[model samples]
Target: VFRSEPPDDLSSEKDRVRVIVRVRPMNTREVDKGDRPILTCDTETSILVDGPQHSRRFTFDAVFDTNSAQ
Candidate 1:
């Protein structure tokens, strides 16, 4: 999770918070082991985790996938 300060003009909204999720790319080891990516970010604010048994969806204020820039 990441937090940011509102502008001085919006100091009264200090109580607000923002959530962010970043999905990292596969490493060399995982690639060598033939591991497949199970997480997908179809939208800018959501992530989908696909598992063998089931799938789950998560929402956030911002979502970054493997291809996102630093």
Candidate 2:
């Protein structure tokens, strides 16, 4: 999530923006291809990055991988 500090004129806590992601599970055909997912995510820390050829890191609010169920 993102946080935005309020102006001094207003008395309030930091404003936040919540982010959520849902990754669909790979189907049978995709499994047969043996293709690998390019990105990996850490739900707890909201971090996503390329599995190979590390170039950059992306931070998120939350992430849901294929194994997760609604």
Candidate 3:
């Protein structure tokens, strides 16, 4: 949250306020080795920016969950 007020020296009577919020998925990395030789998986999210007084959200689901063969 951000708030701003016009300088006192200013003759105009105005004030400004801004708010921003963002949500994203955490990152995950996994490595495994098997008959395939080697395997690796990684997941990440990019940063998002919204206009003033805006909200953003992101969600993702895992297709498969397994233990590392290493």
Candidate 4:
């Protein structure tokens, strides 16, 4: 499912396409294999990727997580 925010006012906003990021939930197969989720969306505008060696945060126009509604 996909969800979208209302468009911004063209008169006040810059002309640019929004960059959205969506993080899907782990599938049953992956869960069965004991794989854990590494991506997390703590806010509407950023995502965090947790890795073995390092963690990185990416900012975007919008971000959605596994629990986000359409």
Question: Where does candidate 2 clash, by residue pair?
Answer: none
RMSD in Å for candidate 3, one decimal? 16.7
lDDT of each residue in 1-70, candidate 4, tens digit only: 3332343553444766678888888999999999999998968998888989998787778998998766
What would the TM-score be for candidate 3 when compared with the true structure? 0.19
The digit string of per-residue lDDT tens for model 3 on 1-70 reads 3222223564433553322223322334322322221212233322223435863432222212224221
Off by over 4 Å in 1: 1-13
On the 0 to 100 scale, the lDDT of residue 54 in model 3 is: 64
Query: Highest TM-score among the candidates is held by which one?
Result: 1
Question: Which parts of model 2 have CA positions greater than 4 angstroms off?
Answer: 1-16
- Tens digits of lDDT, candidate 1, 6-29: 245533446666778899999999
lDDT score at residue 50, model 2, on the 0-100 scale:
59
Candidate 1 lDDT score relative to the true structure: 0.79
The candidate 4 region of ten consecutive residues with least summed lDDT is 1-10
Stretches off by above 4 angstroms in model 3 are: 1-14, 29-70
Candidate 4 wrong stretches, greater than 4 Å: 1-14
> In what order do the candidates fall by TM-score, top score first?
1, 4, 2, 3
Residue 19 Cα positional deviation in candidate 1, in Å, after optimal superposition:
0.9
Q: Please state the error at residue 36 of candidate 3 in Å.
A: 31
Kindly report which residue pairs in candidate 1 clash with one another: none
